[model samples]
Target: MEARTKNVLEPLAFLFQLITGILLFVFVIYHLYVTHLAEHDALSYEKVVERLANPSFKVAYFVFLAVVSFHAFNGLRAIILDTDFGARNKRAVDVLCFALFVIATAYGSLLLISF
Candidate 1:
């Protein structure tokens, strides 16, 4: 039963990783262009605040943060699963990865909200 469940979830997890990877690529390129290639004045403190004041921008930025955090930790989980380390303690690996993901995403959210 456990093996059957693992088989079912493995494909879903792979698909999730693929989708998140694509999203991260798009989000990162957009972020880089906005933060780095845009006019210097575009990133002024006031401008940043004004941008975040828009609800759409705020929601999109939060999604970006969540996607990036999930992708990073999911990748870490995949790497761990590929090694002997995870074979002995798969549940621990999953718990650690999830905890880190939550912590990272929460921290980023706080920063965005408080800014």
Candidate 2:
């Protein structure tokens, strides 16, 4: 890739990772807080399920899952590239990573929709 393209893509990828990470963190915290309600006898497990079944919450969860999966898969690819593995088999590794990302994303989407 050209230097200009690299410059643009790098920042975009970084931004994506940052945003996804923050969202995932927020989701985790929210999940914990909601679960904690049970401890106080203020919320039941069924209530949690009902809340998740809400259309808005379901959409948010699906989006969160997508973003997190993308961020994580790309991060793994970057890590591999940073090491000798990518140097030895750059083309093969890149192809493999692309395939894995597609497969994972599709499967995750299916699960999110079906569930």
Give lDDT tens digits, candidate 1, residues 17-49: 899999989988988787778868778889889
Query: Tens-digit lDDT track for model 2 on 5-112?
Result: 757866886797798888889987866776674456426667656766678867777776777677777788778867897767756765787788778878877765
Q: Note the residue pairs that clash in candidate 2.
A: none
Best by TM-score: 1
In model 1, state the lDDT of residue 60: 84
TM-score of 2: 0.70
TM-score of each: 0.89, 0.70
